[model samples]
Target: MNAYGINPDPSEITEITPAVDGVESIPLPLYGYNVSAGFPSPADDFIEEYLDLNQLLVKHREATFFVRVSGCSMTGAGIYSGDILIVDRSLDPAHGKIVIAVVSGELTVKRLVMRNGRAILRSENPNYPDIPAGDELRVWGVVTSVIHKV
Candidate 1:
């Protein structure tokens, strides 16, 4: 069993290195007014300031990385198959926090749970079971934010 508490399915996971090559920080104009999703409101033409996503999303540049999710195991936690997750290695993997972990060399994303003083990686979906994190489990990073297009 892997981090999902079931036999590891090779097709259900994929690991990709964060794309930082030739990527430069660009500051975009941030508006002051908050857009309403419930109904359309009059446009407020106010420029707050220049906002850089790198500075906002990433806390520690060296310890932070991005991962593309590839499975529905974390759907219950609002993470979809194509979501981009911002993971920070410097943060502590506390209980109930979603994390990207490598179990026996296999990479998987799940919530960290404590059971009987032992760490167990649990899936957000009820279809999956909780996998006991033994000595071989290595936490890659803690998920700080998830981004997906509406």
Candidate 2:
């Protein structure tokens, strides 16, 4: 199981297809994340209250994929370099879905916006520019969830 509550076994996912063009394959982190070896001190209740043993387990029938993030363009959205993004292709892609897209031969992760017959990829940070998607743009998958460290 992953941090975003997904099982990574191939047999578990009902949706499977061949890889698309220009899509760099990324590995999903199926196991849980661990930063240190020892248990957290009693003073910190975040782990105890939220991540108890009972909650750490997951059923194997759910659909989930993991993709490692690159670049800081999504920093404003809380997704940093090396963070694992949980992508649920089973979910429908709607407006405002943080999607992994292939635009003009590049892989980009951004918020999906559609208006006036144009699909725009909006960045969470103002420093980055918005990208317009035409017929050549491909919406790879919708990012259902994100997993990152504090």
User: Top lDDT: which candidate number?
Assistant: 1
Clashing pairs in 1: none
Clashes per candidate, residues 3 or more apart or on different chains: 0, 0
Per-residue lDDT of model 2, residues 1-150, tens digit only: 422233321112123333233444343323233548774444433332334221232111144456777667777888777777666555676788888776655556888988886788777867666777666577777775566887
| Candidate 1 structure quality by residue, lDDT tens digits, 1-150 | 653456773323455656364669999878777776653343445667889888889887778888888878888999888788899989999999998888878778999998878898888888777778778787888989988989
Q: Say which candidate scores most in TM-score.
A: 1
lDDT of each: 0.79, 0.59
Please give the lDDT score at residue 1 for candidate 1.
Answer: 64
Runs of candidate 1 with Cα error greater than 4 angstroms are 1-5, 9-13, 19-22, 38-44
RMSD to truth, every model: 3.0, 13.0
TM-score, candidate number 2: 0.58
Show where candidate 2 strays beyond 4 Å: 1-63
**What's the CA error at residue 138 for candidate 2, in Å?**
1.1
